[model samples]
Target chain A: MSAESITLEELDATERFLLAIADDEFVTGQRFAEWVTVGPTMEEDNVLSSLAQDEMGHARLWYELIDHGRDLDTVGYNRRPSERRNSILLETEHTDFGDTIVINFLYDTAETLVLEAVAETADDAVGSRATKVLEEERYHLEHATQWLERLVSTDEGRRRVTASFERLLPRSADLFAFDAAVGTAPSTAGILSRPTDELRAAWRETVEETISSLPLEVSADALEAAVSEPVTNGRAGEHTDALTALLDSIHAEGLPADHPASGYHA
Target chain B: MKLEERIAAGQLIESGDELTDEYRELLCGIIQFTANSEFMGAFAESEWIPRAPSYQRKLALIAKNQDEIGHAQMQYQLAEDLGRDREQMLTSLLAGENGFGNAFHYPADEWIDIGLLAWMLDGAAMQLQHSLMKTSYGPYARIMKRVCREEEFHIRHGEHIVREYATGSREKQERLQAGVDRWWSRAVMFFGLSDSRSEKSERMDELGIKPKTNDELRQQYFDTYVPKLRNYGIDIPDENLYYDEETEQWEYTPPDWEEFNRIVTEGGPETQARLDRRRTAFEETAWVRDALEAYDGTTANRFANNITA
Candidate 1:
């Protein structure tokens, strides 16, 4: 069988890759959406809301690429928290606007590197979906960087932004630690052009470049601390208390069991 | 022709035109009121985003909230152009000195309540805003043109749930009915005082700011929702509600006027809680705003609502 032909190992690699990226997006989208009504300004609220929708839509797009024989709702919303593979960074509760900007900046930077790998290496479906996500993700990076610049430019803003980076950056190590297969198996299967460790390194450099330009106090030592990874590998289905709580609200009980995906009316 | 004469002739009011203070003030007032309503409504409905039963429902609800917030942005921009700052408007809302659409002050206790909110209550608001698409205020009419289009989708989002539950298992039907009962009176009071008492709206109708009177809009709401709810076997909760064939009006027992006045002035069950939510959020993020202001080399924003200051 040729590389492009069907292979169990390749399919396993692909599914793992997609689930990791899609779960990251899905969880991040939910966290971003919680900012909808109460951002620092109305304009930022709208922008953050749009970004949330984009991430969720991206999640749905990636979920659609899976052949799990489950409906999109089940794939996207019904999975147990123990089954989800999102980074703990994405799952953590946003403590402040500083957390919002820092997480967005950190997450989107890593997302760009990962998506670019899929876009560069994978063919057919994965490549096309990655391409589409990368386009929407361009603006997300801009939104993050723009906010970071503004927030880091003030004394109080800089203090909070720096503190948020200190607290959240270490958790972001999970971004590249989705699966042990992540480091070499996906690229060998021709699914990603580069391995996870290489992408993780690039991710740090890109994030460093962005933060260095700003007046943020995040240090090289702290960046190296973020490199110490996989204390809780998200791909292993271990999660924080936040993910469990998020699942309870999202896949809520008391909804009619017979409710349809188009809503029960359909 | 003078502004009044042009207004009488159904001329569309545009910005930058010389106008009587009354027309301008009235225009600014309604615009501010609407902007506040959209802002408050978006905030109220957003709690359901995490709780929507399906992923599609969740996304649709978020999109609906986004539209409301977008509408608030446009409305606030128009309000700002008319003389008030958007920051002041937001500060006023948080301060609770400004009143918004009364329906949002109540709590949506269940997903069913959110369903009623979008279907029944938003359906009620669509009646008034739809007519405002033809309002004599050109800027407002244009905004309403887009607002009503989005609102139509919101009502359908609501109706989808309403129909599902109303026609579902017995327990489902009971929950739907319960939600209808809770929201019905609030939806009715959304139109405000009746024709005789609503002198302010009468002036608005004359000025073409509100092209329909409160009673007329209330009747429109009844005409649209009554039969649909009845068909779904959801009770209207107003036993006194009936169409008077001879007068061609919805003749019903009005909602408790004293309660209406109290909710309007002092606010409803969730008003303080929701406002406190906003107040806490605002205070929590003051550093973000200050940082932006400082970075932009501007003084810290002094939002100047009389009540806020």
Candidate 2:
């Protein structure tokens, strides 16, 4: 089959975007799954494991969407780190459920914002995929918000959460960092509502406005605009020490070269 | 009494209408006490799930911690049913206004602590829970019956690890003994003061929730475990520990109950750090909760209704 007949440019953009999103979800979700037997309480274990599994499911859906029909063993597991674009936020492993909760919520919010923006794209495949994710993103946002409020309402909880948020807040805007992989800038390519700095700003408005009641503020008043340039490129294979250590422990066994291509499934 | 007959007969006494004001106060206090303690313990124990040494152990540790949370839920539900709310339990625990379980207040330390806790502390708990399986209180006893089954697995899991270290290399043996040494005093303390002098023993015994006194239970522990320790060539931490054939019970140096009481109430070495972690996670996700609560009323609820239809 001719490539153009089977794949839309928008679909191609979506396949790329979803792989990164799915990878971020899967890695973080697997990390969180480590807490299954070890949660602070039995109730928290069930809840955490369930969420971890949900993230795996999220990854699965996106994988199928991006599944170009290569062996999973080859493309999913054996690819060099450069071909993977999952954000660094999801890669850092913190055993503390508190850290897990904080990290995951921040990512869920940023992801939801980006996905919703893409849902409005003129391309049917991109918009359709984005729409599918929008439904699940709502639940993700809700779960994160609930725990965030519970933490902030108390003095000690507020202190700990604020610290974690500060650590993560600067990194979140990096989700929209454009690479050649994301296919030239919207201005350069003349695409509608491509994920530009402007899109991130609108997302900032939506998030900051919603969380205004809480103590969180961008590091400075100008951060909403100025922080668009990422201090680190998690999507470009740059990662923190924590991410490196976590990957070493998790993928202790390297994948074979012939694994299927990594992407979301249903 | 036969276990089944005792369980059956006690089930009758469980439903009696003689709930006096003082009895209500006492029972409510116990329910709240155990519920709060379970929450604090559960929060601490969960840290072990990810760091467990092996795949099989990982699954076992997870199951044990899961059962613990389930036990907490059962206890909390009973507390709630008795008129105390989840909010009160949460407040009492997070605020440090109530008792948390003893072992959980301490960090798991090394992998050996997992085995020691399972073998000894859990064994102690099972003894108590087994008695409580026939407890006078209806709901608490019923919950114990389920919890006891899971507790058995915990005991065996603990045995498996301890035995592994005992029979393995010298390094493994050292690790095993070191774990026991670190945990031995705590295990003794876990059963509480061996004193026949304490009012707690009198109160629990009179209520029929605990059929044996703390000292008697400690003796039972020594009798059951000392010979086993000897058989495995694992030394008991307490030098003075010995079993009396005449009394058909073992005796040992008593743990510092004052310290036990202190640690369980005020924070222990790891308390502040763990609590800080819990609080941090909760605050970081407040927006998600808010969004969820908001959508629960509008988009989410509507979607649910649509799906159901």
Docking model 2 quality class:
incorrect
Per-residue lDDT tens digits of candidate 2, residues B199-252?
755665666656666677666666677777777788888888876789766767
Tens-digit lDDT track of model 2 for A1-266 = 11121122444654655667766776666577676544443355566655665665666666666667633333333344545567766776663445666776667767776676666653675577667767876776776666666556445555666666666666665566645345556434433355466666766775676457676543553344325666667666566666555544533321121112112111
**Predicted structure with the largest lDDT when compared to the true one:** 1
Chain B TM-score of candidate 1 stands at: 0.94
Candidate 1, residues B53-118, lDDT tens digits: the string is: 778888898888989988998888888777777677788888999989898889887788888888
lDDT, residue A130, model 2:
66
Every candidate's DockQ is: 0.42, 0.09
- Backbone collision count in every prediction? 0, 40
User: iRMS of every model, one decimal?
Assistant: 6.4, 10.4
Candidate 1 displacement at residue B204 in angstroms: 2.0
